[model samples]
Target: MRLRNHEGTPVDPVPFLVVVGLTFMFVLSFGPLYGQALGAGLELSVGVSFALFLAVAFGSYYWQVWTARPETVGVVPASVRAVRLFYLMLVLAVLMIGLAIPLML
Candidate 1:
């Protein structure tokens, strides 16, 4: 389903979904993997990962909402910012996963 802002403008969900998915994966799997690589136990790793995920996800949401506010004016629109954040998150996630894989094996 499509999301709408306060102005009733349709917002693209792709970037949001991508960010969520990548961040989810980072929490559920990548965090633990990285923890293991660092010789940490599963429980501790997962806990830390979950906390980090929440922080990142909430921060992203906050940024999006803040940018979309009527008082906010910028050269870039909220949708464009969302897309840029998505790309940045995607690349970072991929790189982290890539780095984690070697440590895992």
Candidate 2:
């Protein structure tokens, strides 16, 4: 998707993820993976983890969109951009999860 800001600069499409993610999860069962994730703490940590997952997932999507192909990705080749966003989300997810370690401890 070609994302344009009010000023018309191409923008990273992370915010688009909420609609896409929810729609996807709605159609497909979030399943045991979701259960296992939420089973922890069941209170504070659950919320945190959910938020973290959204952050990471969005990172994956835009990253993928960016890196796929210029025709597919828009503005530029998508694979490289997509890969970058993926790694950005990965690193952020790791960092966020790492932050959670202290709470778990």
Off by over 4 Å in 2: 1-73
Which RMSD values do the candidates have, in order? Answer: 5.2, 9.4
Q: Cα deviation in Å at residue 73, candidate 1?
A: 12
Looking at candidate 1, the ten consecutive residues that score lowest on lDDT are: 64-73
Count of backbone collisions in candidate 2: 11
What value of lDDT does candidate 1 attain over all alpha carbons? 0.73
For candidate 1, lDDT tens digit of each residue in 1-105?
766555665566555567777788767777787787789999999999999988887776555542354334476789998998799879896888686778747
Task: Evaluate all candidate structures by whole-model CA lDDT and list the values in order.
Answer: 0.73, 0.54
How far is 69's C-alpha from truth in model 1 (Å)? 5.2
Model 2 TM-score is 0.33
Tens digit per residue, CA lDDT, model 2, 1-105:
677544455655655565467434532333223444656444545455556666666666555444433333456567878898799779866865664564455
The number of the candidate with the highest TM-score is: 1
Candidate 1's C-alpha runs over 4 A off are 1-14, 69-97
Model 2 alpha-carbon miss at residue 25, Å: 16
